[model samples]
Target: MKQPNILFIMTDQLRWDCLGYAGHPDVKTPYLDTLASRGVVFERAYSACPSCIAARAALHTGMEQAHHGRVGYEDNIPWKYAHTLAGELSAAGYYTQCVGKMHVHPLRNYLGFHNVELHDGYLHSARYSDIPYQESQFVADDYFYWLKQELGTAADVTETGLDCNSYLSRPWIREERFHPTNWVTDRSIDFLRRRDPGRPFFLMASYLRPHPPFDAPSHYFDMYRSMTLRPPFVGDWESTEELKRYGRIFDSRTGPADPELIRQAQIGYYACITHLDHQIGRLIMALIEHKLYDNTVILFTSDHGEELCDHHMFRKSRPYEGSCHIPLFLCAGKEALETFCPSSSCRGLIELRDIMPTLLEIAGADIPDSVDGTSFLPLVYNPQGTPRTWLHGEHSYAEHSNHWIVTQTDKYIWYTQTGKEQYFRLDEDPHELCDEIHNPVYQERICLLRNHLIDCLKNRPEGFVEKGRLSAGKSYPPTLSNA
Candidate 1:
């Protein structure tokens, strides 16, 4: 009974419905499609705090946002978790390594992996003028440092004049082989070629694409540029005035005003996804060539999702389905698949925190006492098993900050700044085109979900709940006082 190797694959800002296996009509992700077909896909997976730092905090620590203390998208906060996914597996005699996107403070914090080949993908905080030379992305990020050496210091990912967070896009200015997505795969394949063969290994191959600067190779961009694609879904609650207010700004949370810009963004985003998918296929082939395919367990997911102009929103940190819902699946060898993943898909609700305990259980390692998440390994074999009754999610995003509760079939959102509420019956409106907040038919269910959120926030330091009710306009911080 030898322990199986683990391949944790993560993509940044990837929407839940962007893959062919997810029934997306426009995107081409044949490798990911095949993986989902053979594995168990969690049809209702979500990121509780749908931002990079908060989501990764949950993923690595197996703790919810409140427990882990990151509720928003702030950067430069130190990561101080005692027990991490990689740390636990390393303690259990597995050699652990992460190849890309640690995204932690001081630019090189390894959390618990034995080694990390870092590339956090064009962070403004890391490249600030006041930062020391040694800690800057130019010197600290492995991939960026290599790029400078190969093409001189003047060469940069921003050479195409696109902001990292902007919806504007173009093809990569350099060779396709030098792209960050390809670099992650290249380094991961190299690791497989020279890993410690006697012991099981835990490898996290994280990619930063389909996020922004939407610069895939030209060939991939051309694949979708000419095809007719679906337009963004507009909700009944969205205001035309709000769209016009922020639409003209680059890197706006509300998307662009021009329909042509939105269409081009979609073309660039889908191209980046297909480019990422092919890179994943290369890793899969490397596994087979090394005869490690049968002994590996591969889990694929994203930190959060891009809004892609859904409901007129462009970026993440929203409570809507496009920003919070994420794709999650597990593919494994024959024996593990037969014993654990007996079904092709499960309807159970899952969050980023659950990844730690599930992978630790698969590795025969100890689930640390600090973890607040439950392993969903049981649900793979028994799809009816409940991982959780509901999930409470929130993010601190200035005036648009929100709190939400979601079950498998419905959702409730409360805007902290304005006390605005929105409800949606997801089983019927999967795209969330209609807001049922004022509808009489769902008032009872909405009240129940609201109470769930109140209970979740009652003990928090921010005083979100007061005298058995939710209070609006409370001051919010990205990290809790305890953190």
Candidate 2:
């Protein structure tokens, strides 16, 4: 069997329901919609940790959050994994190259990518001054250096004047070509032209857009600026007080104070997705132009999701579907599509960690026994195949930490600090509007899920469990950084 090229595309902080194929009312993602029609879409994919670094850790290492040693958003964590997706692919004779954000510690650390054109957008920890030469963002981030070269040394994200983590929206201050989204695609196309043609390639085109700063190019922003965007899901079970939990700028934990601001942010976010979709289309065209389209397996997904004001939450690091659920689609090449199913949707729960083994399977590379994720490649022909029964998700940030057990039909959640329980029937209430934990009808259901959660946490390294029970009020701080 011949090895097929793998084109893995990832976006940061994009929601699962933001695409037109997801039945989104207004977000126009024609390219993605078309791609979905030609691919198998994983309807229930999720990110276990629901934060950039931890989620990427699971993605890169094929290990769950607990196994990867990061349960929350921690920066500068040196990825010391001996076995990585890229490493294995490279070992298997694939030329591995990453064109965008890796989010790994010692920011420039390529893990096992033969080369990385790194660009993690506006990370404060990496940009902080007094950084050592080995860890300096100025020297590490290829995009930052390129931006300086194009816009002069004085150029910075501040030129846009939008808060990096805020709900504020704006058009890109520079030319659209200089946008990070465009840069990733441009660099990826360059790689296609310059790669070793004899060897099968594993190219990761990772875009940092649709994440935050809500900055899209003017034309793309115009596409949604006047359009009526989808409103955030304000669940009846969610406390209104959560809207006021944090201020209105820079890492706002809660939703916006003004409802109009929410609309603006959604417009910007949707625009970013569309902008990203256009770039994806360009890259696909480039693949065809380079004669690599029919023989390459293209996978599109995200590291995690952004709340976009869902349940009065604005960002990731939560157990809610808005933050944890992610988009996943795989389109095998023309020749490979004969064995793979297309225009299909699978309900089996898939996680970010699954990407590693799935790609390894496609490349005929060895799937390490240490990997916690199982390949869904078998499901291409057997869509009805039974997958993992459930997925355990958790994240710790601010004053709260959450642990959750999600199955196909329902999700049960527990707040470790507050010991609050919430349950939602995903089959009926996909938006999670009603929490049925207090409903007597779900007592047995809730108990089953809680026990599952307890079982998952029992042997956790963080010791969130004690004697087969979750230790309430336990504080698990971020300790997985390179420091």
Candidate 3:
């Protein structure tokens, strides 16, 4: 039997619940919904570190944040992993290529793919004044180079006056084909037409939309701008004073207090998602047209998730479900499904790390000893099987830095800087509207999860654990010594 081709479609900062198949009332994702129906959806998927750099590290290395040495959202840290997903596949006789964001240091690090058409979106670090000209985003990104060629050198993604990390939004000012989302699909389809026909290929179509600048085409933006969407979930633990403190700042992490601003942000976000979904539909069509659909295995997921004003938070790096929880689903032809995932859905816990081993297993490649992630193919065959009892997640975000333990049905969070803690019974409160940390009835479960985190952090360099208890107020850096 011929080895199956792999299409790994990744989106940035997309929330798990924003898809129509995931029961999102406002967002219309017909293509993604159709994709989910044809495969297994891992309902409990999450990004352990809940930040771009750390989460992508787990995805590429098949290792947890600790093993990968990136625990937070730091940029320019050299990716020095020995074994990577693309590397293993490439070694297994597959031609690997990545078309979009890799988020690695040096801006052009291939991370083991045979070739990369790099575009990491608007990275602030890459645009720094002192950075070398060759290392800058404009100099290294293929999409930007193409954009400038098509519309002169002065043309940039920042023309709409929106900050990349801000909640502010507007429709794309250029032609629809010029959008980054469209460019990724355009390049992917082009790849399909010119790939090595004799060998199976591994193509990672990584997109950078729905992350921010929230600039989808006008039709997509208009799709949800007039609808009555769901309001952001406000937890009982949130302080109104805190919300007001950072409300006026355009790029505030806590988001704005104005309901209209939040509503506009949601409209723009949903628009970007729908636009991305349509681009995915184009890729799917291209696969069918090229007669490669039946011989390919497709996996769709996001690195982490957007908070989108949930609990008054607008960005990621939080332990909240809005930040850590992500969408994960895999689909394939009839034969591939029978051979790999023979189920409709999986209820087992999953993280970004699991992506590497799972794809390597499906491709008939040997998973490296350096990988700490479980394949999760077993869980797809047996949906009720538990690959892991729980997951330990953390991020180093200054005062809001936190460590968390999450299972399929609940989560325990510990704020390292302030010694504050929060516990949520996810099965009962899916939106996390209530905090049960101090509740006497659930103290035993909380204690158990806390002990698990302690075990995970016991040997850490930051001294997060001391004498069987969690140590707070210790300064933590984003990258470990290995990085």
Q: Rate the local accuracy (lDDT) of all candidates.
A: 0.91, 0.87, 0.92
- Compose the digit string of candidate 2's lDDT tens values, residues 1-483: 589999999999998999999998898899889988988889999998998888988998999877788888777667788889999999999999999888888787888999999988888887777778767777789988998988889877767877767788899988888888999999999999999999999999999989888889889878877776667887778677656756455468886878888888888888899999999999999999999998999999998889888887888888888899999999877865457888898988899999999999888889997699999988777777757989999888856689999999999998888888899999999989999999999999889999999888886666778876778787677554321
> What RMSD, rounded to one decimal, does every model reach?
1.0, 1.5, 1.0
For model 1, how does the per-residue alpha-carbon lDDT over 74-150 read when each residue is reduced to its tens digit?
88788888999999999999999999998888778888999999999999998899988878999899999999999
After TM-score superposition, what is the CA distance of residue 130 in candidate 2 from its true location, in Å? 0.9
| Candidate 2 residue-wise lDDT at 320 | 88
What TM-score, computed on C-alpha atoms, does each candidate reach?
0.99, 0.97, 0.98
Task: For candidate 3, give the lDDT of residue 256.
Answer: 81
Q: List candidate 2 stretches off by more than 4 Å.
A: 245-247, 480-483
RMSD of 3: 1.0
Ranking by lDDT: 3, 1, 2
- Which residue segments of model 3 deviate by more than 4 Å? 339-343
Model 2 residue 376 CA deviation in Å: 0.4
> Measured by C-alpha RMSD in angstroms, how accurate is candidate 1?
1.0
